[model samples]
Target chain A: MSVLLTPDQTAFLQGTLSMNVGAVGRDGWPCVCRAQGLVVARDRRSLTVLLSASRGRAVLESLDAGSAITLVASRPATHATLQLKAARAARVGVSAAHHAASARCVAAFGAELETLGYAAGLSATLAGVLPTDDLVALRFAPDIVFDQTPGPDAGRVLAHT
Target chain B: MNISLESLRPCLDGAIPAVVATASPDGTPNVAYASQVHYVDSEHVALSFQFFSKTRENVLAHPYAQVQVIEPKSFRHFRLKVHYLRTETSGPLFEYMKAQLAGIAARSGMAKVFALRGADVYRVLDIENVDPRLLPAPAPPDALLKLRRTFAHLGACDDLTRLADRALAALAHGFGIRHALLALLDETGGALYTLASLGYSASGVGAEVALGEGLIGVAAREAIPVRINYHTGDYTYHAALYVADPASPRIPLPVLADPHSQIAVPLTHGEYLVGVLYAESEENAFFSHADEDALVVYGRHLAALIVQLAALPDDAEPALAAPAPAPSGAPLAVRYFAHDHSVFVDNDYLIKGVAGSILWTLLNEHAASGRRDFCNRELRRDPRLPLPDFGDNLETRLILLARRLAERCPQIALEKTGRGRFRLELARPLQLNAG
Candidate 1:
């Protein structure tokens, strides 16, 4: 069954909170890590997560074989969570726009963590090491969208119209 | 070079999240993001088994797995090669993981959904530091130094009173903790009664918290350390809420309105649940992994010390000191509520439960017979004080009563005259109101 992302969720994906990508290997094992950047496609039908080359090796290798990808985006201040699963996945070179979006996301994420009571200088310090020089954008069209907001309806799907 | 699990503690503490990857026998892999990987010991770690759909199946088929962990401050990553061990359905570890998960779920607003079915224990086959160490991070000067000082202070105490004093002092002076408490288990009441505290306007001594009710109670029940980094509404145990709740209608125990960070560690002596040690701070994530680590070490020492002190025989009292004449003043009105065993002095709430009952009995004896000297042996034999478990807590109760009377009802005080004997000192005339 296909699902769609709500408008609010689309904005959330494009927001500055923390983002993570989980992908299964060819042998059905999973690899996940913090993403350097995330951008919800303008169409709101797909997402572009800039995977860090140094840390996301397994995720990058699992891009083929149509290995499933689950993107968990969360707001640090509110603990608001959204998990997106996609079977149709591919990795492409990071575009100029992807870099801009990724930059915006990291900047906002650090701010969010700060606002949520983490000490100052933490966000900036984290951002310095997170920005990857070379990146690959793992873009996937969403086949399943779950509420995952840490409650009863967390895993409930957003059914497609 | 092979690294032991002890060296990887900074990674296993779970301040940061972890990722688990498992491959199927058919060469297909699955990945699941986990909130934390519980470090059971040096060679073992347990993962929460909560409605495991894919990871379970994949792990069953392919037992070998890899976990990636990140250091919060350093951004350093470590990988662990682990082999799946048997799942624990029940035991101290399961209960510990279950309680910890409840707190995590509550903070994340998933309290009801994130239930623990079993704890999946894994044997660490190897630990690899993926990211090269950058200027090896030194242990915080305060944590290491403070833990040593705290342990030393606790080790030197020969009695429970001095032990408690040094423990609280270490928390405040050595560890720089503003708020902390030590409550011992009341097996008879199935509760933990507060005996000592620091950084509260009121010591809240003698306050009763039922087992499995609040953070401290749950920690004692599970016999595990419950650490909450960020405060949430779900776990906040308000005094007023408990008064209305049927489970614990005795008295509402006091805790900080909204403690940003709280950690409660259970004190155990062998198989017995001795008590719980709780500390909180207004600052978010106030307690670091180091703080928890230090406190854990201190708690173990404190528990052993407590057991040793408990095993000692009662002390001999000094010759009874002559009771001084009452000061010239108005009679102090001591109102006793039989319904809840709450005592009020001059209409001010003093204490309730066993402590309250103990106070009323003390005052009654002083008013009738003019007897000021009391001993632990007699209080244990008192028929009206609702003694439980063969007076196992007589001296502690006296200590609690003495402390409460000292803090709240200054008109009346109980000064220790001997090892297990105390002389009731009245500053003014006493008018006892019994319900």
Candidate 2:
């Protein structure tokens, strides 16, 4: 059965969490890249993950309709982690709204990194959040959510609302 | 341009957590932060599998993975396409990773949560620099040249004591190793005793480490080199395992209260455990894989020299010494315990075990006849002393006893008159007591 993200989980994923998006290739091997931000829909059933076009070109090219996708979001300081798996995902066209939302999220992440001993501009530098930066968005409705908080209880399935 | 994983070893230090991406057999992808990405070789790498997470399950189903590692200093990212090879639960690699995880876990305040279950080996199929921008990496020191020079200096030593001194000196000067120790293995007792040490406030000579106690002991027991780049309280041998017994005076093992990096290399000759060479630094990640490799080679040279020097027969005749005049000052009380053969001078601990027995025998003969000269052959044949077999390390025990006396109580000193011969020089008159 498909599962939807809980209110708390959706809010946490949209916050300053470090995100990594992965996609499987035709050869069954997987490719991954660091994502800048995640924007969850009002229904909390679908989300848009953003990545730098230049750094994530290989993963972007592999993303198609019905392509298997996984996005892991983790809080660096606490190592509180969660994995969202979508059996079908696709690359979506980028819009100015998506870019602006990603920019604000990246700024928040940079502030979060600052508290964790990273430099001020580190998040922007890592995410390539400049005005000239090219961003790609992959949208998927996760069907499974797993708690990956790094302990014996990790990999346990999270209940959906 | 082609890039080798060997050149990017600094990225594997766990300074920046690496991300591993794998897929399930049904084409579902899994991505997570890898606890550790250890460099096994140019073609192989190992990741710490602490828990059976989705990543582990996916990798078991689909063996291919993409690992993204970043050099912390430059923040340059490199992607490695790897294939799962196998997993090792126990062995040299497992122990190495386990020690590494302990340190990492302690640093992150997750010491109990993070335990290494196995070392999952992976074959790196390809490597890619995510960004084309490059930073100039500094050239590493020539370890081969340093090892060659150290071996050259070791080849010139004449005796076991001199050989130990020269090797420690070489480790300091040639390899820039500030703190180092060389210990000789006591096979019958299943322990290793410190023969020589440098860069410690105390020489810690005559100190003992059981065959399976700490880093040095573990290396000796496994006959492999073990290294850790961070301080780990898990292997606190002296503080946790050592118990002081009044029956036997314990020689405290010399240790840095908080060592950030340490490496112990076992000195072995085929199947025989010869000794262990150990060094530590206050800086994290100070010892590299190249340093470990050089030390392993250097340990071999040390083992061969020890065997060679021990087997050489004494070619010089025993020296004849005149009886010394008794001192006029107050006598110093020398007490001997026959239980563990511990010897104390002026009610202070000096040494114990075989060395202690040798000292008691020498002092007894001196009190009875004022004899100052001795030879290795006589000590081995003496029924009163419990000396090991002829091929065993009688010379090393004398060296340990000689060093302990030189450090603790300089009133009595042993000087080598020639090979296999030595003279006991006493500056004070002593009253011998056996309790």
Tell me, by lDDT, which candidate is best.
Answer: 2
i-RMS, each model, one decimal: 3.7, 2.1
DockQ of 2: 0.59
Each candidate's DockQ score against the native complex? 0.28, 0.59
Task: DockQ for candidate 1, please give it.
Answer: 0.28
Instruction: In model 1, state the lDDT of residue B23.
Output: 59
Candidate 2: segments with Cα more than 4 A from true spot: A1-11, A96-132, B136-142, B145-155, B235-248, B320-323
- After TM-score superposition, the amount by which residue B71's alpha carbon in candidate 1 deviates from its true location, in angstroms, is 1.9
Error of 2 at B126 (Å): 2.6
TM-score of chain A of 2: 0.87
Q: Kindly provide the TM-score of model 2 when superposed on the true structure, using C-alpha atoms.
A: 0.89
Q: lDDT tens digits, residues A95-124, model 1?
A: 898888777777887777666544477667
Every model's TM-score: 0.80, 0.89
Q: lDDT tens string, model 2, B1-435? A: 289998788788766678999987778788988878999988999999999887899888888999999875455678999999999999888877887777666555567788899999999999988767555335568789888877766668879989878889888777888888887787464788889998988888888877767777778777888877666666542222432342356877777877877888989877777999999888777777778889999998889889999988875676777667766577889999998889999989999888999999999998899788999888889988876665468898899999999999898999888899998888888999999
Judging by TM-score against the true structure, name the best candidate: 2
Local error of candidate 2 at B415, Å?
1.6
